[model samples]
Target: MLAILYVSHGSRVAEGVRQANHFLKQCMDQINVPIQQICYLELVRPDIQEGISRCIKHGADCVIVQPILLLSAGHDKRDIPDEIEKARAVYPNVRFIYGRPFGVDDSIIDILVERIHEKHSGSVQNDSILIVGRGSSDLETPRAFSRICAMLAKRGISPVSVCYMAAAKPLLKEGLELAVEQGPGKVYIVPYLLFSGILMRTIRKSIETSVNRFSFVLCKPLGYHPSLIHLLRKRIRESIDYDRLSAQS
Candidate 1:
């Protein structure tokens, strides 16, 4: 039997962990697979090895490990894969397949649009968008972030800019300054994050401080939206197909 193991970058905040669990439950309902489990990368219970062990215990012959991350950063490239390698050594007989992380997808753009609509009542063209991401040291993630900004601009969201919370150039403060300089009627701060955590709190604090200087609205983090659920399901199905094709060849 094929089992699905959804892994997220866990948070220390209780609400963040709760949000992840809640999102996983929603995903479990939509996914067709019967054997599914969720675990965290760090700062939470039932880490990667334990998640895999549970799947094995449940008689899953092959396990599909899906990363619930927004970008292909260190976690996607090193940490998660290293954990899976360790698990493979422990359970030599169980087959493991890794899925790709979310990378500049249209559905993500849709989520950002939805967030904008939910938070702001004014016209989009008149407002500037400042998209914030949990910055990465990897060059690819920042490139992907730039792509997202370009995509938004193509969709007629004028004067859109992207910045990072950490590990990259043009941090959130700088991005906000650029947005303010645009002289738009209002500036919307969009967080390109999966769940609420310390980053979200920090973004909120930054916005609060800047509100006196310019019109700023902080949209909620990209939580368990239906679009995200669909994207994750698609990744899992694609991974399963790839695994089966590899096995046959």
Candidate 2:
């Protein structure tokens, strides 16, 4: 009667979509729900409508829609809720509970520290870290991102800075320039991205032209991790519990 639908902002790149699917599949064993499904917001198969339909077909009475995103941006806010409204028109009786994304958790910063260590493990004190964010118009996006950056900074990773891919101040070029100005050390460019896509490629292309190739290390995006799977499991549990409490009250 309960279903967990994991929603990701899909990509034009097949490998990006594949990576999202593979990551959710990894969650199957760890999470216990009657019916679990994966869907995308755009540029991929099994869009949100179809995902909801499938849950109904499988006899789910209460569906927990979980956004598999790093931040609580437009997709998690306006877009997905809009789609859920359509489903509501069709399934007035079925309960739908929307859940949160990872959203600037401390554990996420730990993964980021590990990512930085993948390349610049030697002397974080000297390393200047640049975090590349997928920007959002929602004011909360940058605020939350800044908090993540601040958390990373408190780790004593000197001069940890950030920039947006679009729709915000200090774009990638500026971020790289600032990091370069930090002076005389390896700058690890950390993409606060979950999967590989046009954004990742864009970051790579910018690095190739804008900076000395040898002086900077392009660290891997925060992709599939066992820890993330556990986090999603927590999200599902908390969502369901809150809904139950709300109904009782």
lDDT, each prediction: 0.86, 0.87
lDDT for residue 225 in candidate 2, whole number 0-100 = 69
> Which runs of model 1 end up more than 4 angstroms from their true locations?
211-213
Error of 1 at 231 (Å): 0.8
How high a TM-score does candidate 1 get?
0.94
Tens-place lDDT per residue, model 2, 7-52, is 9889888898888888899887777787999989988879999999
Q: Estimate the overall C-alpha local distance difference test score of candidate 2.
A: 0.87
Runs in model 2 deviating more than 4 A are: none
Worst 10 residues of 1 by lDDT: 205-214
